[model samples]
Target: MRSSSPSPAPPVDLAKARRVAVEAAEAAGDLLRAGMARPLEIRPKGTAGDVVTELDLAAEALILRRLRAVYPGHRVIAEESGVNEGTGTAAGADAGLVWLVDPLDGTNNVAIGMPVYAVGLALCAGPVPVLGVVHDPVTRRTWSAVRGEGARGPDGAPLRLAAAARAGRADNPVLAWTQGHEVGRGDPVVLPLRTAVEARCGRLLQLWAPLVAWVMLARGDIDGIVGYRPELVDLPAGALLAKEAGAEFRALDGGPYEPSIDLPPAERGFVAARPALLERLLETTAQACRPAAAGTGSTGGTEGTGGSAGAGGSGGAAQGGRVRLTR
Candidate 1:
């Protein structure tokens, strides 16, 4: 005789996923570090000066094999190979658990022997990520975060987001900037925003290596990161890490980045920072968002005095089509 009731769904094991991410990233990083000494093929990936090397393919293959072996029912979206769909029960679920992988996040830098590449691996239950891991092969440094459990560093210590922010007493904070290739280098909106932020900051870095920037932000090495229409694959994991470390990750419209569990990825342009800096960041964003007058080229200007960017909420960015995806 067969059982009458259907079997209960297996629980999503985030701890296991986090462990896998760490191992896979480290493994991929080892391969990437080795490949750096003897690289053969490199090709242009996009118009925005992105490149893909043979190392990228090798690392992705290694990661996919490890991930598939463990969670055969999980979907994966890797930078080199694109999306590989899942099978069996988890595939048919409404939320769709997925792994977003950037096998060689700083491929161009690696190709040039800059030694700044990393392996980014993340697991998400729909748009909300359960964990994120970034591993720097050269330095052997790793930053990881488990949602609701807090973020951790390579030394296995919890990140001191607030204490670190307080310790840094620089009048002008250093900031990292990230934008998708689709946003255009000279985009009118981005230009003014850049000009405004750069004018006030001690420095505004455009590393061309965004995952590195994300790690820096999570580690509190930089004050904040401002992004305009960043990539989906790289965004969620980084955001989760930063948020878990007590940073606020939200939209440029002064709104909460309320990700939908069953919907596609939707974290657009954002200001990610500690609480003390959140209001000021949002103020500057609002000031920058104002329409530029005729013929001044939207250059630099006086920054906002400072105020909370609480609860403004993307103001129809969803319904009014203000926020857009990179793809």
Candidate 2:
């Protein structure tokens, strides 16, 4: 008997995928908005600075349910749940379609009544993030993107980054940076990098919320963002959003940001900026990683306006704190 030919993979409808991601994100956003009204039940995870709330679990549950309902045989890797193979499907078979969910991106901000938190969801095919959606319940704005389809705003208007050439200029550019929640001031990478960025940029905004930083960059409200030691849950959605919005994304070492669920949390961190500015940003970051100058101090100065982490603000957690829901 002749050997049988292998079957081709099924076609993926990116538009439909984008819609499902938005719907699921918005559904979770509803839960988050409602939960924010009540007194939050917060507890530490991993370390004192890392925290989880009741709303995080509830919002994650809604997101997973909605995503699984729409894509029955897809895999899921959520912040709370770890990993779940699709219904009746083997692990390897469902690897091509995976949903990465962060029900609540900024728990610390939420706990303090700061409206900077959001719901971030992204769909990856094998190792590529093909769809992304981030919903801010407070602002009622939803940002969505499909690979090659471009990013869109809450009003469905096309979102584009500021021109790369203009972004490279040193004139009053606003750059944002975030350190791992558990990382301290003594970290060789954190302090110097902050000092370098502060020295180079006109203004430095330290917001612990990565999703907010990504949204601001996509909307042209910020010039660039550099996140150090970001967790998997915090990187995917924003990476895709920035990529689709004409921004350049790379690991701090100048490599492509891999979208695999199996890769460990980035040690060198990640950088996303307009194409022209990315090279310089990387150069500055690399130089900062070297030995500091004799008189260099850790304090980068509080030149920008934003609440610090001690004042009900968060930078982003090092660990994934969501409750796991086994199917």
Candidate 3:
């Protein structure tokens, strides 16, 4: 006999989720800010340029504590510590709830006293993010969003992408690209795409911080952002904020971005741009990825519905040179 389909998970309370995310982010931000005042002992992680300090661990611990207090049974994926199967609950029952936390998004920047860093958190029901919060301790600014409620700035003002588009500065749109160590070496599509974007946009800003870039995009401080090989903790909050603020998110190959915890690290890259500029930017990126002999064709031009073909493996580059988006 055939088995019946599984029951759907209960509806998520987005407002409550947002509150939890905000509380965790703010609490983590405070810890980071306080820690930044003192001298830190920095140590390298997996790479020479990739480093972590005591504060990173401390901040993550604080965030995990805050989240677990409210959601003891939900799974958590954090940067410093890997996955935690909270409360040892059944996998099927906990599949619908997960938290993605990036306690320190710009560790390098913070170590160098650049004052550009953030605490980002996202509450996801399966692959879809329901609530997000990113807090910048240095500037005391916060950016938040609930899936259908829209994004908001620190002052509680609703953020809309048109704010930047209507400012009559589309011609001078600025795009931010990641300068993380993983970008150039791990992802071949990134360098060429960066060159193409730089040539097309008025100016390009290189940022080591993904959360900062996303916040800037949502607040209309920047027109667009593109990142490659982003960590799981770093992208979810930013992706949700950008989507809620009306930014268009797509893979470098102009396909939809499937946000999921199970996605491989190689597939963690995306282009978030204003609606008017998305097509052109995507086409430019696609052209950069195409073989020299193959003439440029229509860049697919499909509206992203958050689904795409699977990435090859958990390697440096995706299979067949096809691009994938993160989180």
Candidate 4:
């Protein structure tokens, strides 16, 4: 095997970082694609909701090793290792750079013969992610974003996302949501997407991983996506990419999702949508979290069911209002 070279030191050149990020993402994506078909050693974690597999661990290790080869000094915040290379993997420091790496976001889907999984990589400077890359190896599509430089397709083909902002509902701006069963207790909003919106135009895709959704949003493939429990590793790159792409992003309840380098997981709550309908969607989700609008228990009340863990139920019944999307 050939020996790997060292990554350039800090005051990271944004351009260089972007190039490295893109290259590394593609390489990591290739590894994932290579391993897709074989039988995977899968196991469960927490409840049935949590899962782990040999592929998940292997992919993460591959990414970590490769990224280190290119940029040894830069810090990393990952799901499996918590934090590494930055301030004892627990504390804060002035590293000024970190790579939020989620080697595989939809491991379950990928493992179970589903095609919705993806590999996500985001580069953050301080608290803001400046570069993002989401790759779907199965489909061979790569989505990327560079802060202030718009998101792009696999071949570096530029997308006109700024113009899409003024697009109307008739345009069928794509909209996505948090993972179906992954929303935590803190997530107070859910989607009851207007069927009219879904029927209007464009495509309706549900790729589970937040990074992939954000990438598609940035690429203008899909118009918008929302997720609450995005950890730092999950959002930084995607956030910068979307912002650079001219897509508006915020907490589903309309709050800031600025990630901290020192924090454990970027505390939940986030949304990304077209400026035209962002506020309205946020309002809709907020309304869904409220007590049933009195006598309106068909969809928004206890009459409704289907919630994951910690969803405010005495017997694990569906809790909260009618925010589950039918479309």
Per-prediction TM-score to the true structure, in the order listed: 0.81, 0.81, 0.82, 0.71
29: Cα error in model 2, Å: 1.1
Question: lDDT: which is higher, 1 or 4?
Answer: 1
What lDDT score is found at residue 309 in candidate 3?
12
lDDT of 3: 0.67
lDDT of 3 by residue, 1-327 (tens): 000123224355667777877878888888889888899998876532466789888988998898788777777877777666667444446556778777887887777888878888887777667678999989878899877668898988988777446365577678887533443333445456668888988878766677888888887788888665455566678878887888887776778775444554445557788888888888887677664214323222211211111110011111112222222
Candidate 3, residue 98: lDDT: 77
C-alpha RMSD of candidate 2: 7.9
In model 4, which runs have C-alpha deviations exceeding 4 angstroms? 1-10, 86-94, 162-173, 179-206, 255-267, 289-327
Show the lowest summed lDDT stretch of 10 residues, model 3: 308-317
In Å, residue 87's CA in model 3 sits off its true spot by: 0.3
Clashes of each: 0, 4, 1, 4
Give the TM-score (vs. native) of candidate 1: 0.81
Task: Please give the range of 10 consecutive residues that has the lowest summed lDDT in model 4.
Answer: 310-319
C-alpha lDDT score of every prediction, in listed order: 0.65, 0.67, 0.67, 0.55
Per-residue lDDT tens digits for candidate 4, residues 47-118, read 325556676667778887877776776777665564666434322433667777777777656656776666
